[model samples]
Target chain A: SQQGEEDPQALSIQEGENATMNCSYKTSINNLQWYRQNSGRGLVHLILIRSNEREKHSGRLRVTLDTSKKSSSLLITASRAADTASYFCATVGFYNQGGKLIFGQGTELSVKP
Target chain B: EPEVTQTPSHQVTQMGQEVILRCVPISNHLYFYWYRQILGQKVEFLVSFYNNEISEKSEIFDDQFSVERPDGSNFTLKIRSTKLEDSAMYFCASSEMGGSSNQPQHFGDGTRLSIL
Candidate 1:
């Protein structure tokens, strides 16, 4: 079974709209990170929020973590056509010796111009 | 800015054949990882290497999969027997800190592996 799962597998919106993607995990984690992948490309790290953190922001990206629910969310404000890519949330668990990130099935976003 | 790099932007191999995917992680990074994504699927973690040994691996990383950090610079992921199911975009990533929440990973443009 996948440790993390994202809600709403696909989303489509206009260029200026806001895009929200959510992720839920099964176990405790040390931190959660968000990544973006353009078609045929590698994942680019977006943001990392520690277990103790409630919210974080970077540029147009905003991420929130609710440990009680074992869930997290990524919000992209004023989306652009260039933002048409897949977004994934990865959880770094509490285990020692490694930073193995368990990734959620991504949310495919299509922003039409 | 230093970033991870992978060679042979793409590779195609026959079934039952052996394939070696190479990567050069960031100069100062200590942790290395291998991940893969099948067409339209999420990126899946294969293994993580630190101290020149595998620190963790997923069930998908069976006996056929192995990783090595040869020459202290290049990290490699070798699939002993290629299967059609093994075809995917293989990615390499590195991190400055080892399993610390303060640092995030830096990824490389993946090597597209196509198993025929």
Candidate 2:
């Protein structure tokens, strides 16, 4: 069964606007990672935020984790047409070995040019 | 940059047929995994392998599904008897470290399996 659930099943925005997606998980995790998938393509690793940490950033992407709420958020600073894709949040439980990841129902984002 | 690689971008097979999907993870990675995404459904974890053993697996990974690291560099997933409901996109992934570490898993372009 899926342990994480992402909010806003789909989002549509114009270029240059900021986009934010939230994910909530059911269990304690060692870390949470975000990934992006282009249409009909593989998932790309975006960023990871450990349970001990609250926020992390990479290029235009920002991820924040709140263990108290068992939720995380991904923020795209300035959206572009190329930024359109499905975003997923996966959790690695503290006891899970070999990097098994439980993924969430992804949020599909569309950036209009 | 190195990435995980999967073979036969797409495969079509009839029910009850056996199928094997192959993958070559990043050269230096030690952990490997298989996941499947049914159309319009969330991605689901199947199994994880490390040190030539099954480290973990989900309930979705039943007796019909098996994973193997037959060679030093190749990992494979096999279905003994495919079912029509098994049609989905199968993904291969690898990570340098285990769940205890903070490293992220890298995924390969999935194989679209079509069961008839």
* DockQ of predictions, in order shown: 0.71, 0.91
Q: Name the regions of candidate 2 deviating beyond 4 angstroms.
A: none
lDDT of 2 by residue, A1-113 (tens): 43767998999999999999999999889999999999899999999999899999999999999999999999998899999999999999877767788899999999999
- For each candidate, the alpha-carbon lDDT, in order, equals 0.90, 0.93
Q: Which candidate is the best by lDDT?
A: 2
Least well predicted 10-residue stretch by lDDT in candidate 1 chain A = A93-102
Compose the digit string of candidate 1's lDDT tens values, residues B1-116. Answer: 78899998999999999999999999998899999989878788899998888988989999999999888799999999999999999999999876654578899999999988
Best by TM-score: 2
* All candidates: interface RMSD: 1.3, 0.7
Tens digits of lDDT, candidate 1, A31-92: 89999999888889999999899999999999999999999999999999999999999988
Location of the lowest summed lDDT over 10 successive residues in candidate 2 chain A? A1-10
